[model samples]
Target: MILHIGQQKSGTTYLQEVLGHVAGPLAETAGILYPASIREVLPDAVESHERATSGLLGTEYPWISAERAADERAKWPRLMARVRAWPGTALLSAEALSTIRSPAVARVAAEFAGAEVAVVVTTRSLDRSLPSLWQQHVRNGRVSTVGEFFDLLARQRDRGPAAIEREHGLHLWRAFALGGLVRRWAAQVGPERVRVVVNPGSPPDLLWRRFATAIGARHCADLPSDDVRTHRAHRGLTHVEAELVLALNRAIGEAGWSRYEGRAIREEILQHGLLPRTDRGPRVAVPMPARKRVAAWAEEDLADLRATGVRVVGNLDELQCSAEPQDVDQPPVAPEEVAQAAAAAIMAVASRDRYAPALRRRGWRARLGSRA
Candidate 1:
């Protein structure tokens, strides 16, 4: 089976899209399969959990928090079994799985397939991951300020961060690290079997060529490479917007990201988050020290990765051990917030829609409103 593991926002979608050779495939020959079937049953399986965190568990996007216990594991095994039946290599990927902190989840995932697994995880640098991750934390209402967010993460290193993860129930550090994931998966498939798909800022062809080789896919050339940016969840929140949302979260504290009276207020704070992050904003800085400290863990984790003895496909050099491909802003809206805003935004849309009839005749002049 060809597994495309994701630490999220790490080009997992682009990689899958590339592998599938979809509208824009990655390699010319290789195929990447996504786990679409899981969606249907996943909702039903997690319905109980959703009851407690329904607003956060909306179907507009499939995101499961780390707090999910064993009972929360997805019900896509039957789908995977079908994918496994296929003759060619199958790529099953979910950024959510990247958050599987339990050693057991890794083992059970492999055991369910009744096969040894080859894990292909793509990674980027901490400098790059932060801006993306920070926005996600903001969206979830876990962080409030870039400086303060950095402080929280710094505490993870100095004062020790279990406090935050304890409070927030997510591990920004572990969840975002490929080597850390490799360590977990290695327990199930053996380290020699784990393959790390390098996130080089280079041309996709070269990267894909290397990735396929390490994974032993016969059709590497068949897959396509994508240069378009993936992991858009971290694209556009400006410092001001991020800080505003973070402040709201801080004030709200635990259950901050949760809906207040069925309304996702913090999410609204981030819905149009990219509007003001103009090119003229504060210049970017070198990643904080805590970021580098996180990067430091890769060396040991990677060593464990190589021990798996599985086919090492790509040019390891091309892979980014600790990357900084430039931090793309988080998406203007967090995925879940986008769904929530869609509901609350209808009034704004209604007001604008009134002009649609006349504007449809006028074209570009149509649909302007309160939120516009």
Candidate 2:
């Protein structure tokens, strides 16, 4: 069993996107089984096998209902039975698996008892992860400011593994505190079987090829890495667009929008609508003050990662932040820029058929206006 555990936002999404395409006869010829059974979870299981891992551990998310959780848990054992029966190599890639506790880790180890299990973890520098994570947090409907989010993470950077894992909302650290994550899996599967693939943040295929090499499937490395789906892979939101979404998230809460309604608007109107228009804008970079602290924290974590003796596939030095700290503060996102972003999102939403009716447009306008 090749278990691709993830440190989220570390090219995991792109890797999973590519894997989903080749998981059938294409992968079978290469002696890899990416498993079409992932579709059993349907609407939820699109790229990664996160739902299955969530089911196996019974991990609760903010969105999962008790009934839905029960159904997911029921599906896990059946999935494992099929995996156990497969004679050749089977691959299970789930970023959620990286966050499991010691007991849950043991449960995972026991579940795959008969197979030779190798664990693969993908990692990125702390500087790169923070901004991406804050955007994701906003996308999930939270209204925390990027500054507020980074400040909290900077303070918690030095905390012990167990301490950070206990707190909710610090999900990024629970997985990307590379030393702890690698050590935990190494303890269960042995250091030799634990492979760490460092993302170089460059030519896209480099990360894909490194990942394929980690899984001992060199042939799969040459497969197409492009995400050709109608809804393409997520690109980072520009500074102005992120702030606009943050503003909209606050409004959604003030208007008491239900979870489903907020999610739909976020995905359809803000994500698809507003985001595409702002690609040329500057991306949200790590704040000057936070960069030094994160660099120091990353150095400490990488030192510990080196001590784990697990095989590393790329230059561990690539994890370091070479940019020197600057004295200037990032310019505040301009009001006009944010307004333009909002207009773009509104225009995109207005163009869609489901929201094209004047009544629906008026309804949306009224809801947002009420909060204003």
RMSD of each: 9.4, 5.8
Off by over 4 Å in 1: 19-35, 38-74, 101-103, 157-170, 176-180, 202-214, 217-240, 247-372
Question: Candidate 2 regions off by >4 Å?
Answer: 38-45, 60-67, 165-171, 225-232, 278-280, 326-330, 351-372
lDDT of 1 by residue, 276-350 (tens): 223323322324444455455455445645665544545454433343433533324355544443344343324
1-372: candidate 2 lDDT, tens digit per residue: 889988887888878777777677445677777765566547345567777666766643434556677778866776677677778888888887776666667788898887789999998877777678888888788888887988888667556677766654445576878998888888888999999999887766788789888988777665663543222355777677778888888899899999799889878866557756634367677877677777778888899999998899988988997458543234788888877777777876675566557657479777877899
Best model number under TM-score: 2
Q: State candidate 1's TM-score.
A: 0.59
Model 1 C-alpha lDDT versus the unseen true structure: 0.49
